[model samples]
Target: MEPSNDIKGLIRQSPPVDVSKPYDASTLKGKTIVITGGANGLGSFMVREWASHGANIIVGDVDDTAGEQLVASLTAQYPDSAFAFQHCDVTDWDSQVSLFEMAVNVSPHGGIDIVVPNAGIILPDASIQFEEPVLKNGRLPKPNTKQFDVNITGATYTTHLALYWLPQSGSSPRDRCLLLVGSLASLCPFPTQTMYTMSKHAILGLFRTLRSTAFRNGVRVNMITPYYVSKSNMLKLPVEAAFLSGTAGGATIEDVIDAATRLIADEDIAGRALCIGPKLKSAGVHGVEDEDDLMAVQERENNGQGRAVWECYAGDYDNVDAFVKRYILLLNAAERVKGWFGIVTDIWSMLRRK
Candidate 1:
């Protein structure tokens, strides 16, 4: 049974997605996807893959040069699909609003099907600096909060905008998804990086909190927690210096893409998380890994094939006590009634300002 009367999660979760199983890439055809921080690296790679599968892709990023170059490259190769780039600084709310507005304007389907909040950065040992400030002129200067703002605030804005716009999934019906990019730091402690770990934990928290409720908008909310040095060694982040670099058994893009596509194309899935890490030899996959390694915590798929993607926190929000059930029902009711008066007041305020 579902956890509540409505806006509830699944009663059960199937095994980790069988990437070998053929999925209908045809489902992606005619759909439109919006990705933030998509100028390079994982975002750029995903753009190429989705565009090749006949999806309209709108990239939002601060890097105009890389964004335009990516769009140009894809437009040339995939003439059938549409590609557009909008310069977006995710930390700025207005900038992100403009990006989404542009997506709606250019979308062939007149709606967004998928959104990836993929823009993130790592400040080498930033936490230690902030916590233990050095005396400059006998006074500590204001610490930089750029990392927290971009990773947390920007992503929060993206999620809020996604909730507002995605409920109206165009004129005709199609799948709606919010694909969140989290990190291994979300599940395990990063002894060296405190701030980064905190931000990822918040992302994981956001996914957990939204998944059960976001379903009310017919949006499937999913997250991917990838290991450091994942895919082409995460060229964007300085993970190479963070350890766990090449041949250190980080996840391949193939597995990340597979897990992502499965969560997206498979409409039945909602409110789930996937961890992408190294594909280890079955013999060594268990005992060989550190206890804290997220990869070691999972059961391998049948046939003992070396694989990456693993399901995180198998609880699907299905088990609920009566008090919890009633609480959720009340919460839904409150949300249904929320913001209307505030929205009206805001509109009037805007009109008066004009």
Candidate 2:
């Protein structure tokens, strides 16, 4: 049986994104940003976006050549705004720490305002086609790759390093934010892409849980989920296979610059996922609610009262100061408990003697 002609026609359609709104350059004035995997792909586009927004950008990527080239280009274009590029492997702790420290040193403000953990690789083996051959047979097959370690684990390492560095860099935690570059795969379950999907979904959960972990620290965390971003015009397809090929080529780039532009416009929208796509509904939304409405809902749910919850974990605190304070409090409480127990025991013993 031949594939339907409609599928071919649908592939001819241009990808969705409005280029009408010119990006605002002043969106990130006085802000400093660090982007990982920023030499190419979505990360690179973000670098330009942030730079154009008047942000001092520090880009980290494994590709030295491209990373250097990008830095040189940015430096030539925006010499006033500090733009530095360093080779960083997200999976490596040393590299991450070095990158952050370098960024802090270069920024005139002494701290980074935004840390975009955007560095990741989509391993060729990540495709889900092997398990569901029937569904993927008619569709173009994706390369089988290690999507989890590169996509999910890489992101984790990046976030962890950012968390580790931010508190120590002499910056108020409230002023720092972590923007995790997630994907549409994280929300929807597309066939044959389970690894990428699962990892991305897990990332969303991590960002959600991070709110609780970072609440006391005053750090805000968020994620951006982008769908098929255009990278190359040549790869633009007239069929499903061609469409997949275009994305794989990383040829057709998306309006990622615009997405970052929009991100800076809103402050109330935090600890949520911002999905980018062709249609309005295509931009999937989650975890966003007005402050008053949220409070009202919480009040009703809690009978007009609400208590904040804190997670007690040893890993969150880096200093002996917090630990010593907690230990002393616990010890003091224990002493009081012992005194009361002794009194009760003495009363029991006295009764026995009687």
- Per-model lDDT: 0.76, 0.60
TM-score of 1: 0.79
Instruction: Report residue 301 deviation for candidate 1 (angstroms).
Output: 6.3
List runs of model 1 lying over 4 Å from the truth.
1-20, 230-242, 245-248, 281-305, 316-318, 322-354
Tens-place lDDT per residue, model 1, 166-253, is 8875868888889998998999988767888889999999998787567767788888888864545354445564465445566777
RMSD of each: 7.4, 17.5
| CA shift of 159, model 2, Å | 0.7
Residue 312 error for model 2, in Å? Answer: 29
- State the lDDT of candidate 2 residue by residue for 1-354, as single tens digits: 933222212112112222233444564776788888889867777787677767888998889999999999988988788989998987777888899889989987788777888776543234645465444667766545556666677788878877866555454433566777766666677665566677778777776557435534545565666665655221234643564653432212444555555554344334544555543211122542332212122333224433121111112222334444565586674443223224447667999994
Best by TM-score: 1
lDDT for model 1 comes to 0.76
